[model samples]
Target chain A: EDKVVQSPLSLVVHEGDTVTLNCSYEVTNFRSLLWYKQEKKAPTFLFMLTSSGIEKKSGRLSSILDKKELFSILNITATQTGDSAIYLCAAPNNNAGNMLTFGGGTRLMVKP
Target chain B: SQTIHQWPATLVQPVGSPLSLECTVEGTSNPNLYWYRQAAGRGLQLLFYSVGIGQISSEVPQNLSASRPQDRQFILSSKKLLLSDSGFYLCAWSKGWGIQETQYFGPGTRLLVL
Candidate 1:
């Protein structure tokens, strides 16, 4: 079975602090790693990383995939209270019709 | 642009009751559909996926079953509900069967079985 593990299951930080969320996976025919942000409802797409060492960024959020290390990291710079939510990482399973195997997710609490 | 729709937004049912959750996609043709369950504070668990009509693949063997009656409509059904089945159900779709495609999700339906 494909497995994805994320580090620091929960974290609390003050506004303006930087946080890094980690996700590592073990799967066959790995294609890409994706990051999502979930507030109260559904998760919203953040970034999709396909190649190693190339970082995908959107405003204060950025992510990079290290295929050789079988891991990915999401970096949030100058975090704000609005950034508090569950950050999810997922890897697509090639043999399972491209179904995503998601990590347990990191619950971030940003306090102002 | 494509969009996925799932309803009702929330439901509370008694045990042994039947279940039918519907998912439909618009502005897309022959897309790959999927059903996922999310327990409290946990990640998504893949329940079923369909590549085409009448083709369903289950990732986990449970009391739930899925069907694709049409090209863009997928339904999840259970003859009898179990208390453990209570959770947030999500519906997703991808452009194709390729490994590189990204799956877009619906708002999800929260089901509570008491």
Candidate 2:
């Protein structure tokens, strides 16, 4: 079975502190890894990493995929209160369309 | 611009009652559709996915079933509900049937079974 695991299920950090969330996967025919930020309703897409060692960045958030290690990490720099949300990592298998195995997710709480 | 909409933002149903949830995508054609369930503070579990009309694939066997009656219309139905069926149901869509394609999600429906 394809599975994705994430570390530090929950974390609390002060404003301006940096945080790192990890995601590792064991999938067959791996294609791409994606990151999402969920606040209340639907989750919003953040980044998509395909090639290993290549970093994808958006503002204060950046992510990288290490296919050899079968893992990925999401880093948030200079965190703010608005950055508090559940971060989800997912990888879609090549044979399954619209089927993505997701990690348990990291619930981040940033306090000011 | 494409958008997905799910009906009945929230629902409360009794055990053994029937269930029907609808999801539709606008501004796209022959898109791949998916149905997923998420427990409280947990990851999403794939229930079913459709590559096209009349083509449905089940990932996990459960009390729920999905159907695609139209090109962009997907429905989740259950003849009898169970307590374990209570959760947040999400609908997602992608442009094509491929792993590289990015999937977009709807606001989702929250179901509570008592």
Once superposed on the true structure, which residue ranges of model 2 sit more than 4 Å away at CA?
A96-98, B97-100
> Which residue pairs clash within candidate 1?
none
lDDT of candidate 2 at residue B43, scale 0 to 100: 87
In candidate 1, chain A reaches a TM of 0.97
Q: Please, what are the lDDT tens digits per residue for candidate 1 over residues A1-112?
A: 8899998899999999999999999989887888889888788888888899998889999999999999999999999999999999998887646789999999999999
DockQ (0 to 1) for model 2 = 0.66
TM-score of the A-chain for all models: 0.97, 0.97
- lDDT by residue (B15-35, candidate 1, tens digit) is 999999999999989898999
lDDT of 1 at A89: 93
| Top candidate when judged by TM-score against the true structure | 1
lDDT of 2 by residue, B4-114 (tens): 999989999999999999999999999989999999999888899999998999999998999999999999999999999999999999886444377889999999999
**Superposed Cα deviation of residue B69, candidate 2 (Å):** 0.3
TM-score of each: 0.97, 0.96
Best by DockQ: 1
lDDT per residue as tens, model 2, A14-99: 99999999999999988888899988888888988889999999999999999999999999999999999999999887664657
